[model samples]
Target: MHQLSRRGLFTVAGVAALGSTGALLGASPANAAVPDSPRFDLSGAGDNPVAKKSLHANWVMQSFAYDNVHQHLYFAQVNTENSDRANAGDLWITKTDTEGNELGSMALHNFGHGVSIAVEPYDGSVYLWTEWMSSSSGFGTRIGRFAFADGTVLEKTSSAVQDRTPSIGDTMINPQPAIDPSTGRLLVRYKTGEDQPRIVAFDLADARAGRLATQHRLAERALPSRGAWGAANPFQGFTAYGRYAYLLEGRAGGPSYISVVDLNGTGQSTVVDRWETTAGQSLPGREPQGMAVWMHPTGPRLAFGFHSNTGGVRQASVFVKTQFV
Candidate 1:
């Protein structure tokens, strides 16, 4: 028998089909579950048979978002592979088509750990929402907005980056941001000094117009728990749709989960959906990284991404959960 290549260990053909929407390769795990309200099935087909694609940036992907209007994708990565944010302030922004093919790339200086990014296409141009102002920990200290310029480098304090950190949550720690492409609403998650994890929402237009202070806040709620999953699990990424927020949490290799928070819920009851998924579990060094909403032709897709190492090269692989339960 021929042995599978190192990269082949990550293949999901045993769990999902390529073109079909709801097929599964094997039986559901004993503890597997979907959301109680309405969200994509945890075992929805991993749609892309060839989903693994390389990004323009050589560093591992930290976070990513989709451009529904422009059909583009923006991925964030740091300059070096060390765990201690060795090259933290040095950043790279990779531009790609929907399938992860690199279109071009740019550089950023003193930008925070690219935790999450929101792509906004408007008025014949495109702008990005991401973390900025690298702090001592190598993470961003504020939210920022700027236009995309391939092959160019921008600093955290550059005039092109508009500071968009909202004033609702803890003023100390900078918030992480994601957009609800359906309504153009932006949701940010933040916490201060070991308090409850919090989220605040605002209209992207109001945020971009410098009206965050004066404009009315759309939503403010606490994400009390990440599905009550476990203690060691790490928060990977998050994004919002119409009325729901989807959070990705997991460790490396196996056993990650998606926690669906109903922003309208009160207190600890906010975590309405807690589904454990084995999506991308087979990939080498597979670690869940990002989640976003993709406006697919059939319907909207819940896109989740993972970063893995293939032959010493960091690679990005994206899979979508189409159709809701």
Candidate 2:
């Protein structure tokens, strides 16, 4: 892995790949001319075969998180065969310096489908959420708490059925979890309907005591389509900044977007802004999935993880917006 400055991450080739529409350079219409609104920049991009046999599997990046305390970029990935229950797979956590240099990596067995990662600001502890199934009739979910020092699992919990919503036939697919830096509240979101998702906020105290606090409905516009391959769930990724929560919509080989919701005094969510990628400038064959936001030395940036397949290789591209609301 190579370390590059935020600006250097966007090479001429990357810019060309994104097209000349300059869609990523524009600001959201709802926001005023805030000095640092939100702008997209390529942080780093590459592809590698996920490790096999536990050494270095060719893993496909699924989710991302930024550790402000330690200033590290954390990514969660799952190997190809491990995505589904057909073959056993492993989940990997790759930690890199702010500049994208690999510092350390860890692999957890019998776990694949790494969906999301979040870092606790107070203690720099890492939290990862993953999904697994043993057979066509069986499914389960797990949340692993790891030490930032060595990626060792300090605590782990699992459920044969987690966050089930029978009304919509959804069972915590791609659950996005984040810890509010200001309040230390653990927020986890999962899709319950075509466009409606539920967000649950757990007090740190209650979480440590194995109890979930309460959940609320996230109000957002209807998705353009059901989803890639006709899947009903449309939400792909999520992160929290201040009192607002941002969600990414998954549209394979189509336009990309991020929905901004205001978590104000009422504790009710209102769709305040919907940012879409430029029509002709979107990633040709990629679907945006995961998102993470943190204040950088230069400014606040929004990072996204896009998944794609090229030449039989599963790839993940990390893109960032240095100036984001």
Candidate 3:
């Protein structure tokens, strides 16, 4: 089975074929729950199908994460286009057995826009980041707290206090969220500035207390490319390993490199080492969209997933055991 791309997982056209937009958001009436079974073994290698055989739906899956506590994997979808009175598809959370069999599932409210997911142990609870449509400025983005188990957002409202927009041509991409275990605060660094665009971090607690503190920002020289299309990693896609953060930035035309930041202090980011995704070629096709990065459970190895343009079809890509050195 072919892997799905980050953006392709929720195409406007794809949602229409899936039935009602509500279905796409995970709004299904209760029914007999499917028993849990180990469906896919991550330790091994192969495709991990998000949906079941009976539901063979071509959902363009964007967000992906596994809850260590509940042992559940979560991902979300949105409308291919605005229809069915739903602007975006709903967020879906599924619990699977060790064999990856569908055990039970639940759907959250419609975001009206796409949503991103990231999980981290914080203050005896899990931290998450989601983007929901905001009417504050008539258009804005919300990044707040959510309950890990049932996907209930603890942040009550979509406040526009810290909202920032990208440039005209560039769009805000997936934000790789991480939490500082030491501080018990959620931390995130995203890029959206027009010139010398940067990745900045803040303590969720501070933002909640109305402080909105910024830890640090990535320097211009550290970026992949300085030109319009020569930007690094198309999105603010990144991964974290032991006090360090690994990020991928792609310039417009081609050339993508990784930036490593030390979180030992106020999360100061520095480009320790740099390498292109492909040695000599330019990054191919529509800016290689969404990305996921994380550290291997055992070693300094890093894990990542990216969008690949395979013959004009966007597919999800997997790169494992990427050494930190």
Candidate 4:
């Protein structure tokens, strides 16, 4: 996602090279996917644009992941800004090249709001790893894996769907999936009935093979309690990278923030780093929405995204943190 090359150059950390699975498999891993330092230099980061042309996406972009294989970017957007219709699990996935030229789009019916999405490239084809079976809250009740077929409308009950949702807790609600294409690792962020939010890590291969159902995991870490980010800070999005995971939080006209978590670390304070980002201040209605690790040809990058309403149409933009200190 690093292309300050005047707002452009890279892949989503070997992503959808995780291209819905296989592509992200060979995605390069710098510092073994999870670096000891979850901290990056935000002060020096730039608001590099990933999309060149205007987005054809219909709603506000929620989360996105990369596909290094075909050099495409996948964006997830939910329909209806109204809180009531927001829970319908209906959203559009707009596909585009790294330069932001809209190529095509897909509609997911009754799929949870696209919190976080994983691109897995498998069998010369691509499979999108996302939450499925929208619950009452309009979030995915389980993880769904399916092909990225353009012009296709997939129902939550579609047979082509693969239920990748792991049996985490007795009442796991709204599970989210993030892929560390760098290490082929997957993180599922979920909340229990007690409202305890947690992130569990697993190998992407094992996860794709259904081994997570048997309790095979690399590590588990706790996310901040609900509203812990703050009463005004809305939960935005998250992504997995090697032994670490990253979270995004903020709202329109922000002060957006990025928090890094050590997946393999056992410390009580799993959040080892927190920093406020002013990377996209120039954009109007700059609400932080997406984050992903990208394997740039030059080096490793952490990509963040935002949304703005331009003349009533929700538009999306992206920025990357290329310097890690």
Report, for every candidate in turn, its global Cα lDDT versus the true structure: 0.70, 0.48, 0.36, 0.70
Question: Model 3, range 62-138, lDDT digits (tens) per residue?
Answer: 44444444444444333333343332334444434322355544333343232244555457865445554433221
Across 1-325, the per-residue lDDT of candidate 2 in tens digits comes to 2221221211211101112221111123211211222333322232221211111234556676777667777776665442334334345567777655678765544443556667654443554434433223222243444454444321123332233211212344434566554445566665434434455455554554445422222211112223343353356677765556676765677766676654431222345434664422334457665777755666566666776655545555666665432
Residue pairs with colliding backbones in model 1 are: 10-283
Candidate 4 lDDT by residue in tens digits, 62-122: 8888886676889898765535543377767888876667888777877888989988888
How many pairs of residues collide in model 3? 29
Which candidate has the highest lDDT of all?
1
* Candidate 1 lDDT by residue in tens digits, 132-183: 8988677888888999988777766689999888764245465788988877
Runs with alpha carbons beyond 4 Å of true place in candidate 3: 1-57, 66-73, 76-116, 121-127, 134-140, 148-176, 180-185, 202-226, 230-233, 249-257, 261-274, 278-297, 307-317
For each candidate, what TM-score against the reference?
0.82, 0.61, 0.51, 0.83
**Candidate 2: misplaced stretches above 4 Å?**
1-56, 82-89, 121-142, 148-175, 191-196, 205-211, 214-233, 264-274, 278-284
Q: Pick the winner on lDDT between candidates 2 and 4.
A: 4
Error of 4 at 154 (Å): 0.7
TM-score-superior candidate, 2 or 3: 2
Per-candidate total of colliding backbone pairs: 1, 10, 29, 29
